[model samples]
Target chain A: MSIKSIAFIGLGAMGAPMAENLVKRQFRVTGFDMRQEARQALVNAGGHAADSAKAAATGADALVLMVVNAAQARSVLFEAGALEALAPSASVFLMATCPPGEAEAIAAAVEKTGRHLVDAPVSGGIAGARGATLTIMVGATQESFALARPVLDAMGDKVFHVGFKPGQGATVKTVNQLLCGVHIAAAAEALSLAEKAGIDGALLFEIMGGSAASSWMLKDRGPRMLLDDAPIASAVDIFVKDLGIVLDAGRSAKTALPLAAAAHQMFLASSGLGHGARDDSQVVRAYRALNAKPANDP
Target chain B: MSIKSIAFIGLGAMGAPMAENLVKRQFRVTGFDMRQEARQALVNAGGHAADSAKAAATGADALVLMVVNAAQARSVLFEAGALEALAPSASVFLMATCPPGEAEAIAAAVEKTGRHLVDAPVSGGIAGARGATLTIMVGATQESFALARPVLDAMGDKVFHVGFKPGQGATVKTVNQLLCGVHIAAAAEALSLAEKAGIDGALLFEIMGGSAASSWMLKDRGPRMLLDDAPIASAVDIFVKDLGIVLDAGRSAKTALPLAAAAHQMFLASSGLGHGARDDSQVVRAYRALNAKPANDP
Candidate 1:
């Protein structure tokens, strides 16, 4: 059956606009958040406001968990009775960035209830979320993928069915984070080395951004890296968390990710240096801190 | 005085075409190489071929050293008497990817002899050399830059006067190599983790090549990484050597480049595993060897 209603939990910056986009597509979108303003913002955007996750999922064709973490998703579904409230044989789209192992466990539990689970995770950050241009990676059975396609189309233009395994989409996302985090940290390392030799950071990036040294992260975050304080586009703690997930994925799969592991250390150091809340580009600060010369040196 | 007669050393894969490009631009070009065919290739393209470095440099306004390393450049300029053979107050464009410290030393020695040394290193590889589209990073005084401008423009379209100090251009090139090496190895690590989870490597790179995960190295070397044997665009030992230079530069400046140091190990292992002559993308093999599941484990 087609999805006419979507129960979207976690009405934060990403979820609110995503739920609103579903509502604009003529689907009945009921969104639930602990914050009244968040729920009200979705309501103002023509989505229904729900006081609880269970209320939002009642009779909905699909339930999308966009909450903060796997534990929160679990609380909403099992503890809050959202799973039981969904219509019989309805699909659950877990769109949060969860560990692959956790996603697999969640899938088995969801499948036990005679419902389908679409393992979906996203990239593209706030602007992509607001503009409905997010890149969504899905891991689901062919049946669930068909069921989720039209609804997923409402929120993202770039959607890929990565694999049929329940945790494969999460794996793709974990890998994506691995590349992004490593690239950002590597850019910091490169820029820091150049600055140590007194080459202008701006000029170095201007040359690198057009050369084989370029990365999406370098072109996007490189200018901000030159600044003493760049406004937060994304916090350093996000990569601290994301690369943590990447390492966890590697461990579970018994893979050694030396580059990712080293990159994560820089993010962890940046966070420990109290720049966790600062922009991700501030990871360069960690490099600077580690490599700065002694005051007494010539 | 304007540069007219030019001496080009090391007429190998990159230098042969570079000398030919200078010939096409109407410079009175004379090139020398150890190999007869390399020198003949330049001669066939309308440039003259000299039997020795000193013979090529005799009375030339500019000497372009595109040799393999600092040792070879030193041999050609000092031991081979090319420095003394140059016209009065001539300029030397050292275009090898040498360590920044070595470039500085070479410049000092050249300056002591009443000649200018422009520390110029290039990227874009053999293809860039042939098309004269190389990105040349130069570190020279204003007078040296003015003298080298028209002559350098004949070989590379993107010529950057990175700094006045002789080693700064080499520093930028060192940092550029740092980013490039880390990016290639990071792509391997990311792809290996995805494959460990049974996700498709091509699909993973396709998603990543569009997302923030993308790098010039990933987009260029990623596809070749999936194949069992990819025809060599660049050998793995190239990075093995380049990242070595990067680390040497970092060490000289007292900077701790953890990411670059980690990436160098992977390239080193790939070379140690007897894939040194293989394509650089085969750094993935080091990752594969590290992370492969047991053959006997069912």
Candidate 2:
């Protein structure tokens, strides 16, 4: 199958860059997003901008779903009729992080319409998406994976064929988020302890960054956590959603995830305290609020 | 200030090798521990084995305390009179993870006895201790740090003078433990999630080890977590103690450490389940037990 034209939905921070990469790689990309600015960004990157998911997916050999969650993926594919709009036998790549059960169900539905569903979820954050260095975990039948390989490669540097099962990619991605969400919250908690102890946060970062306690999240998010007012990179609400997906998956699998559950609470507190739109590093604010003392006492 | 003699207390997994490193470096070393085997291990490494902490400290230029906790340090220094046994102006290195307040109190008492305290807490685990590659975070006056530099260099490949205060090393160590403990529990939780989801635990380890969710603890402990019965490298009780020290420090500073508290509970549960003596990686067992069902049901 000679696949060329691609439809990309959800032109957000991660998806926009990924769609841009497809355009740069000379794939005929048609992108759509709810946000006009996001759609405009895609148009600026030399991709055609469609008004809706269905319009973007129409006549395309492949449709990529990079929306926020399973609900959005469902709405776009079913409610918005993107699945029905895609050409018969067109591969649908679900790049969003969703529950494995949800992915399997969606795959079954797509299969009934004579289309292939490639359960491909990605990691490596926004910079990776922009640079086309994202890691993609793909779950699909051999034929579907073969049809989606070039498109996956165009958006990600490392592609792992995790399994032929539909939800395997979501399972792997859930595992990834389980760690990522916990690590981010853990970093926030540690830095909060450092601040409360009056230890120099930057110095502690340098020391721990070189020590056995270090994680990719601590090294990547540690500096942002130190800022008096950090810029929003990834918002706290994202983990609120991601970890929710993680816990749901665990619940579905009859697994108890205490650490992930605790981390979800941390993110929830951050969101509750009005930091949902702020950088996830601001989860430290939740800790600070909890530990707040009389200003004059110290 | 030609520091030729060293007194090392607490010859456990970390201390015995540290003392051995000093001996290998041609320093005159005397080591002591409650365990006969530990003391014999030091003796086998060509270091003098002493009957007590006082015996170890007597006439030494520096005394290194590698005991389990602040209580042990207090017992060795006050109850056992190791402070009175050391020579005047002798530098004492507190190499164990302890509460900062405890270290400050010990430093004050050591100063009253005309001895110096260098709060030098070490990391890099058993392999680092044996290979002389431990990272030592030191808190001391310039004179005391200068006095202990040669001795510190003999035992650790990387040494950072963290601050001038006595408890700064403990503060830095608390920060380290907060991350280390939480990361270990996080790795266990993620691996358990994978196990329950029927994903290959080893494959998930490889994939996540290379992803953004990766950490030193995850990479170091992840493989061990997958084992049916992993060897004891660092025991669960160790984190129980370290994170307890961390939470104690947090309490003293009036900080809220939800993640650390959650991880502490995981370790405590692991210990409560009789895996305290097992490797810390066995914390996954705590997760497994929680998620366990009738074997044939799944």
Candidate 3:
């Protein structure tokens, strides 16, 4: 039930906080990342730093990959020899938002190495990551889920077993991102209309938040959309990647996702407008450019 | 503050229940509609029945228009001579999902007749309407809002005064519909993909509904989507009207609403498939036809 030695990879904003939570919960955590500062933050939180993912995974009972996308998750666990380095019975939790197909492939590759693979993608933003209240959706054998329970508990408050397929977690996560991305863009569009109509955006937020139009994305991204400019937590490129996964998944299944496609285009337009690195709420900037002003100029 | 005498127009699913609520709450409600059965149902609920909207509005303290669209609202209040029949200080609570422009024009027309107007579009679906727990969004002057508050209390649990602008309530309602329309379509698309991927549709619904993809629309529409068929509470034609209003509003404002437009297209596709009068969740039927069944459809 205890994670004696765990390896965490890609300690970025989300991963760093999650890895720290694991360490703070008294797990002997070994973290690896190309970003020295990210790894250093995990190290400062009582986790050990490793030079490579393989080094971190060697002798660890569990390996958690929190990389940016499927490519990174694959590169670290499969390509970089980390899967081979892990103990035969070690459980691997892939928490990155990636293509479902890729998750399925990676899970198969890990399973081939005689290790348990937990397709665990999480929600709840940076704040949740640090506060250890994230929601983790798992698509794995019940055995693997049970094995990874302690580590998951250290990282999230809610852990659900979605299905028996490795890609189910990624599939559900893509759906979440599809809704989140579309809702955020929709919020921008509606708020822009309000602002163009001379209604105060703040008051609109207050009213809508309490109304049926309310969603997690609106409550989270609406205020940030009002900020003229702000620091980025989740960047625009994340949606570009996430929504691309959604569209690709839709296309693969021959299922048309018009709203997701439209949302994809806005994030594309936002990225195309050179705000890709900015906060995802910067998608509002696309709306601002299309409509005149969503807020009075400071 | 008491609503002793009132008229309720458009005795359809929502309007009939709402009219009954007024009667249940001790208001002397006069119900009007072209449908004899609809009027009879209201009369059975102890409300007076009138053959015309003007007949209902005449000498009443307030007239609540719960019609289908702006055209019906316009025909009743303007074209049908209801405005001329209502008392000078009588209030008109326009509680239908119509275009913001229509709401604004109606408000102005009512105000010129020395009548108070409250743009009070509602949410909570048919169930909410019947249960008297609908959420009402009001856009009226302080005096008008205060005047309509008692009647609103009879119909809804929450009444939000969005702004003093006549169209503000419709604008906010349109925003709510925008999210609902897009979220429902997105839920359909996602659930369709999950089904195509060989996952159980009901299980996927249970999983995603418990996860971050959860939204008011998704949770509300998801179960119905799983059924090959279900009763039509709201229909695809409804979204066709609502999302049409959304896209038109966005286009007139020159605001880019790519998500709403895309969601609108899905509803159009469903309508084209001849399921316009079926449940709006039947949008998934379009996906079902286009997508190949999972390998293990047993």
Candidate 4:
């Protein structure tokens, strides 16, 4: 179960830094992405850049999928023939958030190819990825977990072996997203209420940051929410996508998620108002717009 | 300007301890409540028991109103003639969560009677009240704030002069409730999702508690939510009341509070399901009930 080489797919904001961390840790890393600049960034970090996913996987002991969703993971592994390109018994780590059933399905497919699959979805955004301080929730068999431990450690400080089944990692991640999305929207609503009430938003943020109402998202995104034009750390549409997965999972489990559903609608409204690519804190803008409407209009 | 005696109204879970703290600090405290037991408790704590709100206010330099809402505060101050009973130039501390406009109206009435109104609303629940560690947000003129500072310090550890306006403390408190109510409901949704996903709820709590998904409410109320019959520290009906005030303030300001509105509905559903008097964590029960419905129904 000795890991020698790794192939990393999807070098986006999160993935590029994660792949960079592994390379800095002296792993022989081959990275691939649709974007030329993303591939070039990895090469600049002293990691090899592959022309295609298959080429990246070739001769690698493990293939890491940091792609956007399950569909992209499927495209990389099956459509791009990355699965066949990997060495025998190679471990595949799915770090991106996806539906539990989708991860399980991908695991089943990877298992059919005589490879191990570790459903290891991660938290702690782009900054965490670069710092190698992400929290990785792993769902895999003991053998697969053993094979992926070093690789997981290289990318995250907190690597939790959540369960011994495929999709369990995704399950934990879905729960995290449910709380994250709701907290962000709630933060926006509180700030918006403060602004509308003519209270100082910054002062309110400071007060609540020390109060029982505090949340990681409230403290993290609250100041950004005050800025009318904050940088896009996480886009509003990410929640639109992540909360969609959450509701889908809730549907599959017959679990109703009213708060998540409500938060999802606010995110959707933000995206609908052309803030999809803006910072998620820009959900406050959507609130501002809603408040700007006449009292009896609704 | 020197404070000598105090009258405290509403000796409930929060008020009784706050009054006890003041009495323990050697303030001549006369407390009154509709319940005889509440008055008896105050009497046992070395504080005088008044037969009525007016009797409590008589000869007192400051009157502390910790009643449930604005209506009750008005009942004690106006209907019960407590304001008239108080000494001239006395200060009235409105320490309950009330509508901003109501506080303004009350402040005007107190001003007409040559009494100062300090709109000082406190956070940190019952335990904080007992421990004298509450955070009090004060809305008062400089003169009135000066008069009430020592009195406020006797009950709360952190007292912020948020603004000079009569309703500003209520405004800050409203924003706090918006976040608190939403966070509590979001915590319930995340825990419920974990329970439905077959993941260990306690483990998820631990993981998320340390992650970016962490929140004060989640860390505080989440363990209680896991219990089938958790103690009623804060009732579901309290959120029902607080969030109602939140939406009321939003309506007054023409502000749209989708998250707060949504959280309010969930609290209402929890109450409608006969958990109104149950602990606020029982909002999870509403989620459980929703999840228990047949899959095809929704």
Best-performing candidate as measured by TM-score: 1
Model 4 Cα lDDT, one tens digit per residue, A2-60? 88899999999899999998998888999999999899989988999989999999979
lDDT of each: 0.92, 0.88, 0.84, 0.90
After aligning candidate 3 to the native by TM-score, how far in Å is the CA of B65 from where it should be?
2.1
Runs in model 4 lying further than 4 Å from the true structure: A23-26, A34-47, A293-298, B24-26, B34-47, B293-298
Q: Which stretches of candidate 2 lie over 4 Å from their true place?
A: A23-28, A33-52, A293-298, B23-27, B33-52, B293-298
lDDT of 4 by residue, B1-298 (tens): 6888999999998999999999988899999999999999999989999899999999789999999889999999999999999999999999989988899999999999888999999999887998899999988999999988888898888888888888989999999999999999888888777776667778888889989899999998998988989988889999999999999988888788878888899899999999999999898888877765344432
Which one wins by DockQ: 2 or 3? Answer: 2
Candidate 2 i-RMS: 1.3
The TM-score of the first chain in every model comes to 0.97, 0.91, 0.91, 0.93
Q: Which of the numbered candidates is closest to the native, going by highest lDDT?
A: 1
Task: At residue B37, give the lDDT of candidate 1.
Answer: 93
Q: What is the lDDT of residue B9 in candidate 3?
A: 91
| Span of ten consecutive residues with least summed lDDT in model 2 chain B | B289-298
**B136-194 in candidate 2: lDDT tens per residue?**
99989999998888889988988988888899888888889899999999998887777
The predicted structure with the larger TM-score, 1 or 2, is 1
* DockQ score of the complex predicted as candidate 1: 0.89
Per DockQ, the best of the predicted structures is 1
What order do you get sorting by TM-score, best first? 1, 4, 2, 3
Candidate 1 deviant stretches above 4 angstroms: A293-298, B294-298
